[model samples]
Target chain A: MIWQFDLFILVLLVITALVALKVRDLLSAAMIFSIYSLLMCLLWAEMGAVDVAFTEAAVGAGLSTVFLIATILRTTRRTTD
Target chain B: MSDVLTFIISRFNYWIYIVLMMIGLYAMIAKRNYVKKFIGMSIFQTAIILFYVSTGVKSGATIPILEHGHDIGHAAAAINPDHYANPLPHVLMLTAIVVGVATLGVALAVVQKVHDQYETIEEPEILFKLGQE
Candidate 1:
């Protein structure tokens, strides 16, 4: 894998991870976490793990995001702490 | 200076994964909301998957599929394993990705039920309610 591209994706992954955890809005955090998953999918694809990337894109970015948003809507949108 | 740069560049993926794992752990431990904890758990699982997949990478290698394996005669030729990326971690991670999502969905469903029971998803509130009852 190209270290330059790897570094770029990794940096964004970290940023999105932190934001996902720190965000007060649960829906926003879920969306940011989906972005994190997409970045991870890109990194895996770059490293030639195509099947793994495809699974991540479909499961991590797609289904999990839908599940999280559904849960947030059914429950609460804001976090207490 | 070049040695330091090379060292850092060569192993940066591992270091970054470790950092991501720690972030996930912190979220799991410190967050008050159940959904936040669930998110942290997903982050932690993804970081571990990243590390495993990175370990399977080889320089100048193609995907794991054998180019000429479909041909009977070509299959007899000695193929160098170094030409292809490792498939083990990718396969393992595919299972892990599915398991992670399954757990996430279950955990969130439980969290919703908890919200229904306690009228809140906060750990402290739930605990306090439980203590009173």
Candidate 2:
């Protein structure tokens, strides 16, 4: 595994996670969270877990974002805290 | 100093996972919104899956697939197990990814129901309303 590439994705993952949690707009948070998942997918693929990466790309980044957005739309767009 | 730097650099993947797990744990505990809490839970699950998959990685080895298994003549060929990435953790994490999504779906549905009944998805607000009743 290339340590440099792994480090790059890992740093991005951490930043996305923080942004997802910090964003007040729930929709934005969901999008950023999906970004986090994608970075995670990249990390797994880099580490040679192709199956896991595909599953994460499909489920974690794809379906989970949709789920979060639908729930956000039905409930509330902005968080209180 | 160089030895210490190399040591940290070599195992940096594990360190990042630990940091991510902490972020998720903090969100799960400190976040007020139910949806955010569930997001935290998802992050936490992903961190765990990351740790497991990273553990399965072997440097210079390809993915866990037989290169020449399709060749009937090579059926009896000796293969080095160390030449492929470990499939056990990958398989286990596949189940984990499915379970995480299922849990997120159910949890979000419950959150929506709570918002419908209480007009708020924040935990303190819901509890406040409950305390009044």
lDDT over C-alpha atoms for residue B14 of model 1: 87
**Regions of model 2 farther than 4 Å from truth:** B1-6
TM-score of chain A as modeled in candidate 1: 0.97
Error of 2 at B43 (Å): 0.5
The TM-scores of all predictions, comma-separated, are: 0.94, 0.95
Candidate 2 colliding pairs: none
User: Model 2 lDDT vs. the true structure?
Assistant: 0.92
TM-score of chain A of each: 0.97, 0.97
Best by DockQ: 1
lDDT of 2 by residue, B62-123 (tens): 99888878876866467888899999999999999999999999999999999999999999
Which candidate number would show the highest TM-score if scored against the true structure? 2
